[model samples]
Target: MKEARPWLRPDRAASGGDIWKKMKTGAGGACGEDEMSGEKTILVAGTWDTKDDELSYLSDVIRGQGGQVLSMDVSVLGDPKLPTDVSKHEVAEAAGSSIQAAIDSGDENTAMQIMGAGSARLALDLWREGRIHGVIVLGGTMGTDLALDLCGALPLGVPKYVVSTVAFSPLLPPDRIPADVQMILWAGGLYGLNDICKASLSQAAGAVLGASRAVEAPTFMRPMIGMTSFGKTVLRYMVTLKPELERRGFDVAVFHATGMGGRAFESLAGDGAFAAVMDFAPQEVGNHLFGGLSAGEGRMTHAGRAGIPQMIAPGCYDLVDFVGWQGVPAPLRGRECHAHNRLLTSAMLAAEERRAVARSICEKLAGAAAPVAFFLPTAGCNEWDRAGGELHDAAGLSAFCEEMRSRSPVNVDVLELPCHINDVAFTDAVLARFDRWVAEGVISH
Candidate 1:
């Protein structure tokens, strides 16, 4: 079995590495730009120690479909029986350790973790080198874990597909899954390849090939605007703001305030992906304040740390998000709430909780190196938080506005408008402030 093969065994008889292997040499586009290769040089990554036969079959299918296959052996157990272009030793080295260390540790889970991290780092390097056009993985569980790690490490635009028997299970956290990651159910793939496995495998092959062949959207030269909003029923500012930015030639990116979406937005901001942020919906801030899932750690801080021009609004600071699957937390039971859907339930926040949200936003913005604006629409922050609405609480809204005004940095402009969050006037105010920032040379015009 491949699991028992020697790690250093020479596939000396196999074709040379140049045709089937990829790694980072790192000459990039103009001024450190990262772009995908036009070639369909897909990486076929898997735990080859136990799944070499399956991986080899998949490679042949990829090659038959006109993809240049870069077979990566991520198995830490031992060598692979199949002819692999990228070996376990390479993956180990990328993780700042050796395969021998993983073997000597004698713990399967630990070894898998090391291999997974190493592979992910290596995948990024290869991607930067334009060596990886897409990624295809064939695994059940451990393989799927590594595949996800790799997918997460790669930039969002790259095409990634995983064929797993346990794909899309609750075992995987939703936040860890990139918005574009695709998975195929590996039915009848638990053991040897049956007709069922082959059918699934064929479909997976087609998907990666098709995605790699598709034309990549041209990137805009305009400054990117990172906009945040949630269910339109609640935070409608994004709807009104996106077009206005586009009309002025700024590329607008709207992130839903789901647990994963909020995390990704802040992450991209920190990575220098946006020129400015129009943080219109901050339900995620309330989520962090009131113990909810819609926000991950460090939601509002990244843009400030990136030193980009930004405008902050309490788009949905009145509510905290808790999915119906988890049921409301003990303290939140019987509180005013809205079930946006069976999967998403939002609990109304108290005045004190809204104050906490305001303080958190203030704390994140205190470190900003560029200009920042904090706006509160006095009429309401969201759809149901308005007068006569289900989640309306004038005191709660006032709490945020008052705290934000008092605690915001001296240089930060904290303003209030007598309008709802979704109102056109509110949108106009945010855009007008952005224009001032650009004109002041705070944000590039």
Candidate 2:
């Protein structure tokens, strides 16, 4: 007979069972009472069958900090030493499958995918029902995979923490990561607990609980206008447009047109979080099309899919931004380049590449369910490409503008303004169209 691991034994007091029971029964200081008084309820999620000891420790720490835990077991094959608030059977069934079906599949990846779908659904349901305030998931690679899904299911401003052996590893792609997720490396915590692992688990528990308490979720009191722009140095329209739009009874959210910022904007827009969009800084479309610093796929399509009216522009269409540290890409070498910082570099596109970017932008806007308007500033699209600016290119700018005019979909209303993108005249043109749209009920206040 093999000897049982100390933490694996059901009756082991040192494995946090005693603390869990105390928390449940109100025997510990303010644990059960705090839970009833609406203390933060964090969904402690992981393969509870294999990581029960570690998950319990995390729950214990949360309870000790006057927080409540809703443990969710996502294991496929084995039973947890203790019952979880959300069992593996419940998880499997949530995805319209059974635990038996998952096991019968006999492939670990397939089994985990079923669990991942179920876990994401349950997490969203729990959030909607006001049962969970935040979530912290534990895993190696498998748990991390489910963690991303679970976190992605919840809206922004909810506390999401992932403690994984591969936290911050290249295995995790930026597009899959939610904008506000917190990750801690599970050092020395692959199989079981020790002092180092406990240090990580305890800190993660406190951090999630603290975040849940401190976070102020979005109120959505005023109608929101989602706008995209780079910094004031390159794109100055937002500086004038945001306040002006707010004066017209709308809140403006300006998303930086860098990679991750555009991802967050798209995610929110896809969820119908915006009343309308000013997608002026759409350089990410070109970035994705040309294999530069990308904001992943589906860049300029989310608002349209959600039936949100869009005011599009070709700001910064003449430049392709790549990671500065990686050196200039071979295809773009010897182009007029600007090193913005240690982390970002921009290369001016050739006339044909600018034309290609223009076509890509038109293609994305062609499918808008609601009204679509494209603003083309013929003098220049970005401040850096103005007449005396470093990136000035008359022929390239002409190519882009001509392509936009020729390729724009019939559904799109193209406004060709004969001013630089930074000019007050350009801003006035956008506002004029926006005001007309509001009057015509194309956009509701």
Candidate 3:
């Protein structure tokens, strides 16, 4: 049997505060004592066999800054000079495989897939056990690939910093990245540690540790309601709904319905974090289907899959958002357009497109495992689409409403209201159903 490492020795484990004491008085020079109440334990993970020096530098910097290190080796073949708290063999086994099996596959992608799966599972376990507060990972591409999965495994607000040679590259898509993760470019240190690379690594260490110390994790004391909307300029219902929901003994979290914001909303919903969902703004659904600025696939499906009661509305569903900086898409080039800003723009859909969007919306809602209420504000779906407004087209609105009322699944209760989406009457209708649901035990109080 191999001898245990010093950090994992039974004696050291029994000394509850030994890790913090040693971190404060470690060999490398200490920065001053942190005013924070407790020492943070940061998970330093990487392909340790190849980038041992870089990973060591990060660990040292974290320790020097009054933080404890939990080193995890994700290497496939070679061993690090120092023992890791979590070994490569252990990581492989976490994924129900072995290092030899990964090597025998004879493919770098295959080996890294095994490592990534193991790393994600171990990282999630560490977080759940309260053994780690933050994570800082280093890699060129393979390490970065594994880093995305590891970060995704943790809930939002846990500090996740990635130092990678391919940081911010096009190779990393919007869907692959977690909403709150921070990434720094690993310049000049691909092969070995240099001054340039050291600068990036040290900053990442301090940032993750500092964030861990400052972060206030969610308490989840109050049952939460998740809602989606654009800014008040377009969707004003949230302005009225947020305070009202709070008064009713529930916490409301309203997410911006842009690409990344919607992605974060879907992620939390997939985790079953919300007691119920008021997913009013589903423009990202049309965006994804039409090759516009998407919130990734499966935008409006998560809460339903989680079996949470849903109140759905077609807020801002008439327009599809795209990257304004890239010019309009070829298919939507000759349509009425509104430039929200330099980064985002919206184009009005034709009547046929509106019917298609209605069909798509009904199709997605058809899979609801729980009850669904679809509110069709017949006057308009958004401020700009109301009568006499800039993008208003009564014909288009009729097309969408007619298709929705005709084709919605039986599981959905299609309420055709005669008010604009931003009208007080519309808000009252939503509140009426919500209150009835709570009273009838369909929604939890």
Candidate 4:
């Protein structure tokens, strides 16, 4: 139905590869005149054919907040109830497919995938050109996927939001989610403008516009330092470390070593988002190595490999996470267990596994092209690993230490301090080593 388009990038569809491709050019038009009016242009994205009234209501709510709305129709079904700035056909075509092709294939899932990919590409193009300040979409499961894809296309700062019936399901894969993208459970967002539906739509629209107005892309004079740690039970050193880091003129961003948090940390580091990294409590590493859902495959690798000055610690290395008592796997059933809460538990790791984890960590860090520092506190790695505590595993931890020291890369400055991970001496040792690296010009203060 149109001229040939050039491809810029190919993205995976639910079907497979090449089902969705971003175009180099299409209807690359601005959303509206709001770009220069000091008014935010909010992209109201959804299947306008099915949820017309709901999408329109959101647009009205956004406009009421003094923001302009760009209705990007991603519908693949019948005619749209309302006209959109970017039409469904445009979105489909932009994704290296067409709505008619999807319709001919007679697959709702495939059609949604094509439109979602196209819509994301279009939204990103518009965003890159400052045509839209934020995006808001409302839907059930299919709509949620499309919304998530669009949100993923934008970076950390843009106001991307999804009001979805399935907000907490597949969205749990934090690696696929953009770090700052927000979501609201779609209690009544899929249907007409009733009292219940209107309340949620209004909130979503307002939240996005407010986010757009309030969020400024972070600019910094001092280099930002990214750190990873768990909760208080495992973050005793971080409390002293982070403030000292800030006092020395480095802005530090601490990532809780939850599965998703580590996912974000990895993404941010890979993108050179942080000038340096202090990956202290890499509990996710053990989680990944032991089939725990919260750990990521590349937890400790990105920061160091980014050629940034990184200080790596095997913090909380003695335990692997299992949620609740019932979640303890059969293999770890009798192991020393610490109940952090009704929802979270830590199980003591075995010596063989600890040694394997340490070797793997060294292998990962071996690719570092910048200043690398590895420190191990020989006493223990976390609260439950210290004296007379539950989940103690000094034998396993020492095994890790021994393996790490043997495999430590020549470029890395490795240290084994004779103190518990939470002890003041351990913190002091970490600071002193970092200070030395800075003085040696391997890093800047």
Candidate 5:
């Protein structure tokens, strides 16, 4: 493993009063030790040399909007306490070692990584001290990178805003902030405090203040029930399992059954994040078994050991996902396939491949406790596998099921539903079995 960053190993750094307090009493007495109370405090962090004029005007606009503003200059090129705002010294003092570590690392990536950790540490400490409810950062590319790191570190519901010159493209690539947070884009560099700066700052302040006032009552305290789904399989879960589970007072958290989606759900289950696993679509494992493109990592089936009430289903197990017709590997170039959409295609898994998938799934479920159940829809498991579609392989599915039943340990109960996976009757059967298990306390509600 790479050597941990200095800021990440803060126990080795120093232990005194908080960074702000130490900065107030040390070197320059730059900022007072007064804590922000009642109203939310917005921490605006940036390079003073580049953003001083912008920061000043933005701070004024925020205060005018009845929000407290605390400006911290991460770059220590000048006095942090300039003409306005809170202690610049405290910000520099806390971030100085981190900035120096980044410079000394020689590798720009490693440097940025350490700096990002430093910013997160600062935000966390401020939040603990009740001095920060939200954070707004202004930057160029480097600044945006550093600020986004801090934004992600804050709580999921906290107000985080970033104004960046590159935010329009590079900074906002996939998404720099979570869906709940706000990010503003500015095309030009921060030359001085202008109208855009004022607007962004004011909006950030109001957001943080509003967020501070909203009471975050616990949404639900019921034991969490995890479900894996795809666009097709999700309908069965949404229309049936979700309402039924909610009626039984179990909080449902659905994870899309894509590769990452399955991995994330498994990880959360392993981390004691859920009380039960209703993994309806084991597509990742199917892909891995079928030599398709959606294969999961080796650890796809880790939920059993986590001791959760696991109920597994092979939703979409009949079809293997592939990108466009041109993107399918040469060996499978002539296989039975269908164009599901412009960017995606589906293919039939061979009998041998289906048997392999069954074996892998059975291997995982074999070790599950008595409460565990594996349901196999004998008619069909997907829209393409029922009535009229290229992927309806009853012979292949039967052969696979027979092999699995013969090979699997008897501890796992395998139920064969006569209805197709998408049918309302099949969904009803699934709910009845699951609810009975939960009601009997075989699986925790």
Candidate 6:
């Protein structure tokens, strides 16, 4: 019987060192320019031990598919900075020869954790620097862990492909991988070049490179507008505000008030990506005040501080989002709660809670651009806040509105709409304010 070959053996006959030298030169060349090679490149990177041949083979396939391929070896050198390319000897030298140290014998879990952290950091650095257009990985179960670590590190638009021997087996939790990742099942291990490996990898390379170069919808050059919503409260604005702003040549981005959505909205706004804000349902404030799910961390109005024209509305301030009736905290249980669906439950705020919510809201909106408006719909903010829904409470609404207005600074105009927020009149009114701001150059047109 043939002896099983060690996975760390190098094909020394090949001039892998020359490739490493070229890579070091190319890295400097690529970093100086905002754009990369006219043709997209895929970085085929992995361990530099016995896996060096596999990297070379995959890089060859990608290059054949009209892509420029760069190689990376994930070995930590004495400096701990990644080399643009590294040879097998350099890798072995960097990582000590103890196979035990490399194997991560703490447990299967520990092995996965170690692989994920290292691979993810390397992939993130590569992608962030725009050195790679797409990524493909070929590996075993441990490889799968590392591959996904790399995959998850890529930004939302970039493509990631993984060909793993265990893809068809039930040994690992697929949930460990992201839903957007592309996975292929490879029979046995990827030892050498073969028809199936070549074909699949070729297709993946073409798919990623092709998509990378495809004509994308031209970026919306007009100012971006970020808004907050939930499936329910902002339903009206989704239909009305989005198109209205788009017609006026402002790019619209809507974010849910769920924990991260509001934060993301503020982040993009502060980053100067968005020119203005139409912060419509801020139910996250209620969540924050009443100990409910979907609570946006404080700093909700940081966008206004960046000098963006903005409008704040108490679209669904009456309710705090919860997961289920049982999930409602003890203090909030007696309050009026509505089950919008199995997934989202909300509680109506009492006057006292509304006052606190109002103060927090006022604090966040401190420095919005001139002509900023804070509107309240007297009839209702959401369907639940109307005449007969579970959240309906005229006195509660009045207390909330009055408190918010009294506490907030004069720059935040307090407007009262007679109709429900979804009413066409309300839409027209909000659009009119948006138009006035743009026309006045309070926000760039």
Best by TM-score: 3
Residue 102 displacement in candidate 4 (angstroms): 4.2
Q: TM-score each candidate.
A: 0.86, 0.90, 0.90, 0.84, 0.66, 0.63
Cα lDDT tens digits, model 1, 321-407, are 887877999878988888888898888888887888888888878887767888878999888877898888888888888888788
Estimate, for each residue in 144-259, the C-alpha lDDT of model 6 and write its tens digit.
Answer: 76776667655434567777777756574433454346777764336765777666656665666676565242133455677888774435767878887888876787887765
- Identify the runs in model 2 with alpha carbons over 4 angstroms from their true place: 1-37
Model 3: per-residue Cα lDDT over 224-255, one tens digit each: 78999998899999988989889998889999
lDDT of 5 at 408: 70
**What root-mean-square deviation over C-alphas does model 6 reach?**
12.2
Alpha carbon lDDT at 62, candidate 6: 68
Per-residue alpha-carbon lDDT of candidate 5 for residues 75-190, written as tens digits (9 for 90 to 100): 53344446434343444345455455556677866655555656666776676466776778878787887776777555434567777777656335332343345666654445
| Cα lDDT of model 2 by residue, 62-168, tens digit | 99999999999999999999899999999999988989999999999888988988898888778766788899999999999888887887766779999999999
**Which residue pairs collide in model 3, if any?**
none
Rate residue 190 of model 6 by lDDT: 64
lDDT (Cα, tens digit) per residue for candidate 4, span 142-176: 88877778887776677889988777776456666
Model 1 lDDT, full chain set: 0.75
Instruction: Choose 3 or 5, whichever is better by lDDT.
Output: 3
User: What TM-score does model 5 achieve against the real structure?
Assistant: 0.66
